[model samples]
Target: MKAILAFAPLFARLKGAMLLTLLLSLVTLAAGIGLLGLSGWFLTAAALSTLGSVFNIFAPSAGVRGLSFIRILARYGEKLSGHDMTLRLLSDLRAWLFARLFPLVPLARRFGRGDLVSRLLADVEALDTLFLVALGPISTAVLAGAAMTVVLALLLPGAAVIYAVLFFSAVLLVPVGLVLASRRAGAEVVAAGAALRQAVLDGIDGHQDLVLFGARDAAVASSDTAARRLSAARRRLGRNAALAGAMVQILAGGALVGALLVGFVALEAQQIDGPLLAGLLLAIIASFEASAMLVRSATRLAGAAAAADRLQAIATSAPGIAEPAAALPVPPGGEIRLEAVRFGYDPAHPVIDALSLAIRSGECVAITGPSGAGKSTIAQLLLRLVDPDAGVVRLNGADLRDVAGAELRRRIALMTQDAPVFLDTVRANLRIGRDGADDAALWQVLEAVQLADFVKALPGQLDAIVGEAGRTLSAGQARRICLARTLLSEADVIVFDEPTGGLDFEAESAFLVELPALTRGRTAIVITHAVVPASFDRVLELRAGRIAERAHVPA
Candidate 1:
């Protein structure tokens, strides 16, 4: 509940619209009750009217028509305002959540992609019911119930007392019981639904591997099991809601009978007329319509609460690295230095230990080591993806920690083996490097990476759609496009981590041939186990978190 309330500030932004919607909803409910009451009174009075008797037909007839018009108009306004507010709120919330998620990336990868997607898409969507189910309905029920009770009391105080008791019992007590009963099951439903979604997404993403590994059947089975569990949870919640609804209906029936009895007694004592009795009875029935939605709203409360908790887990989790309160500006020259830097995912096992290195401005260096020698870790530290545990990594004489991550990244771009290629047009992918780069600049970078000819041959050229993760392009083509993107950046320093991991001899050689031109007048760090190009100014080998060897490569 507390987690759900954390969005109060967001709700505050639409307070004006929400208040308007509430007012309209109240009017709609009131109009409905008035219409039913007026119609019943007019019909009964017209039936009892004798031939040529003096009956005020015009007034009641106009009242019925006016109430009907009000009901229709108010209902339309209520739905229109309510849905408009909901759409705006949902749009704002999605953007806000993504903004929060942006700074925590790479470290946020600890939560699997499927799980994160589920939270972003499904969990956030579940909150739509917060306004539609819980807030609007509950508020309308309270106000309408109170207003009905007062109106009835004006006519028959005894009938009003009975109506209030039954109304509260149905709206408050029964719903509370339903909430209690559905809380655990509703939570289970939400959790199971997320799990099922995750399983299905994982299967789709890894279906090839599953099939090759003879595990496709197992994957299918897992998804099926999750679906069954989700279905069972949903069924449980449905049963609770139905039971609560039945109880409300029973209470409403009792209120109707009580109203009838009270009306008959009052009429016999000459306290009220026949038409007034009929009107009051019909109004009591119509009032219960507003309270009818309360039970369903209460049942959904648990699921909404569960979704809020899931979203809060991501919202409140601290980022991998904290931003400095006062960040230093990036220096003009790209000089990187690591002094006694030590870090590891686990405290007991350090990846980089007491490692010290320095690269002069605009120097090209190749760092080579076998697998798990902290080659990639060095790139991560320089980019400040993960902070060093012990010593300092500095850029242009300022500690990386003292500079904002975005600023540091602006000065130093990292291109990895698995650089993500989004499912968008080729122009969109290239624009990620330089937001406003024109077609000429794009072609220049593409040519530098020797991929311009292939792209130009495509039917759509720059506008060509690249499939998810660049699956539409060959592996070597994808890697070169990533390099072209990196080259498009105006960063003074660039780091490549196994950039040619899956390339063949010819592709690697072609990339190496262009290495000198690509790295000219820029600080470049190539971290890989593959053959280092002879054009590098210096080569260093890392072993067990230490620089074990250093050599100069002849130009």
Candidate 2:
């Protein structure tokens, strides 16, 4: 039920292979250890038995050679299985993260900058120790320590017990200390990255304004501050890494020192032969690697734990808009009406209050308003981009809340203020509203939007790459492509957030020819920042989140 334990089921998918590997390694380690103890006894016996060196060596030589062979096999098994388990856990983690992220981006964007990136990239990387470096080595170390203790007790009881106690303390201390050290760094890294992401976003979002105001220096300075914070966090994390290494060395040194003192006392008492004492010390040294690995794994796991926490929050986050299970049916004609609407993105920030308007099935309504007076919000509400806090948005007498979001969206095509051409071909961008639309359909919409000549002249024709965010195309050209997308939708309703923005004389003249064609036979709400089309059938003026004036004219 808890996140810490929740990862178990996902990781458990590879349990069989992991267990197989564990079994192989344990057997391998035990066999190798037995061989070491036996070889040590033989060496001592061979040395003591013969008066001359050559004859003494030959008697125990075969046993020592066979033991060495077993040790080699054990080492191979341990390395192989440990790595296999790590790979499995890594795959499970990556899959789990992606599944959580798919539906959460829209909600996560509202959470603020740097949070998601830290969780996804940095935190996920840290969590790798949950399995890779942690579980296997930790297990191996415990088993090896137990074996060493029993062997040590045979030679010297007090020394063996002390060694076991030191190991226990190191095991307990590793994960907790590493996590505490990394917690602040993980949080800081996320914060700094968020600042970095926001700075770039701000600059790109305001390219025109920044250029006009000559604020390049300010943008660069803000971006540099974000970069500096990121570097500082890295420096802090680097220190924690060094500390983790120091902890490992301390644990290893303690074990080695205890083993040496106890072996010396046993040799003096004649309680064990010389070869056996040497073998016990060597085995402890070999197995100390497990404890060292535990320390490293602990450090890595801390980062991952922080990341998983963020990702978990994102996956479970509820959406801003909730849709009903059963949708209310709207009439065939797509007449739209808003009634006594009070709405805003935030509870304290109602952008439109008590606003009401109605349009017939095929009439065009040009919504004109001062900036931030809710013209775009009206378009958003009608499209169900966001649901209203109070009041109703209706299509043909049916409430938007009762209509399935996907179904309602299908009946409408929106060209929004944030509309930018995708990094796709001209034909590809236009077909966004219409899947499986052929070349003929593409040409039809392009001609209507007065971009046919431009489309024809591009080297790749319809296949040309538009570049990132349609940078390859002029703003007016990009707008025309979006308008063309509306024609392909053939939806009952259309909302244009800003149709004539970023246009030149030639583009405006071209826009006039095709704009009406796109609006024909569609219930339309056109929001504009610039000139309102006088030819539209009706216009509503909004101020302070309410309709201030309405005028009707013949087309």
Candidate 3:
């Protein structure tokens, strides 16, 4: 409940729309009760008048028609307003979550892709019940119950107390009991659902590997376990709801019987007439309709509460990196220097221990070393994705920590070893580097990467939809597509990690030889185990977390 209440500010934003929805709901309920009560009275009065006194038939008939139309129109308006407010609230939630998600990049390390998707999609959707099923419906039920109690007091005083006790119990106590009993089951449902989603995603992503290893049955068994857990949790929640509904029905019957017993006494003493007594009893029955709605909504309240806790955790958890209170601008030049830097995933075993290096602006440098020798870590340090532990990384003599992350990234772009090509058009993928980049600019980079001919031959040319992760393209073509994207960036410095991956030896050598000319006038750092061409300005090797200068490069 504390977690749910933390979103009060978001709820406050749509207060006006929420109030409108509530008003329409009340109007709809009132019209329904009034229509039922008036019909009962009109029919009874007509039957009684046939024995003696003259009762006008015209007025009651007109009122029944009028109330029916009013009920229809109000019900329509209520549904329209309720759905509109709920959708707007959902939009706000997605926007809010995404805004926080950006600073938490490298989310792959901290969160599983399948789990993150579940939070962003299923958890957010569960919140839709907060307004439509829980708050709005509950509020309408209480208000309608109170109004009906007041009507009974005026017309059938002897039965007023009897109706109030049972009706309020059905609306309030029964639903509260259901929520408390199902809380654990609701959480189980959410956890099981997430596990099921993760299982399915893993199976799909590793289908080929599973087949090769003859482990398909193991994967299927894992998914089936998650499915069975989800089914059991749902069954428990449903059982609780069914019991609560039965309790409400029992109370409704008691309220009707109690009201009838007292009404007969009032009639014998001449305190109420036959027609009015009939109308009051019918109105009491009609009001229980609101109680039924409340019980149904109560079943979902528990799930919504659990979903709120998950969302709140995301909203309040500390970001991977904190921004400075007053960020300084990145300096102009692209001179990068690492001063006695130290860092490691585990502090006891450092990957880069007191390493220092320098590269002047417009210099093209290549650093080559064995795997797991901190080569890729250097790229991450330049991009400020991770900070050094013992020393400072500076840009133009300014500490990287002092500059804003967004500004630092704009100045220094990185093409990681496993850079992905999104499922989008060729033009769209390149535009990620520089939005609004024209056709000429895109074509220029494609030609530089030697992928222009293949792209031009495609049916959609620039508009073609590349399959997921560029599956439709060959391995080398996909690699070059990512290369083209990095080249499109306007940063002063660019770092390429294994840029020649997937290409033939001849193509790799050619690209490496032409790398300096392609990245002219920029500070380029190429991290690779491939042969470094003589065209580069400097070549250094990293070993044991320290730098060693290489005496020669391949001609």
Candidates by TM-score, descending order: 1, 3, 2
Write the residue-wise lDDT of candidate 1 on 1-555 in tens digits: 788899889888999989999999999999999999989989998998895368878898899889888989998998899999989989978987888787787734567665787678777777864887787888888899999999889998779999999998988888888878888897888788778887998899999999999999999999999999999998999999988899999999999999899988999999999988998889989999977888888877777888888888878889878999999887698899999999998868999899999999898888998899999999989888888889999889999899987788789998998898889988899888989999999999988888899999998999999999999999889988888888899898999998887889878767765776787988999887766667777889999999855666543
Better by TM-score, candidate 2 or 1: 1
Q: Rank the candidates by lDDT, best first.
A: 3, 1, 2
TM-score of 2: 0.73
Candidate 1 clashing pairs?
A: none
Query: How much lDDT does candidate 3 score?
Result: 0.87
Model 1 residue runs over 4 Å out of place are 52-66, 107-110, 208-225, 325-331, 351-357, 366-373, 417-431, 434-484, 498-512, 528-555
Distance from true position, residue 525, model 3, in Å? Answer: 2.8
lDDT of every predicted structure (CA atoms):
0.87, 0.73, 0.87
Q: Write the per-residue lDDT of candidate 3 for residues 1-555, one digit (tens) a residue.
A: 677788788889999989998988888888888888888888887878765346777887898899888888988988898889889989999998898787777677666766788789878887865888888888988899889888889878767788899999998999899989988998889888888988999999999999999999999999999999999999999899889999988988998899888889998989988888887777777888888887678878888888889888788878877777888876687899999999987888999999999999999999999999999989888888788888999998888888888888888988866789899999999998889789999999999988999999998999999999889997778877887888898899999988887778887888789889988999999999888989999999999899988886466
What is the overall TM-score of model 1 with all chains considered together?
Answer: 0.85
Candidate 2: list runs displaced more than 4 Å. 1-4, 7-109, 116-130, 133-162, 180-244, 266-283, 346-349, 420-432, 435-466, 499-502, 532-535, 548-555
Candidate 2 colliding pairs, count: 3
Model 2: per-residue Cα lDDT over 131-163, one tens digit each: 546566567667877887887787667678877
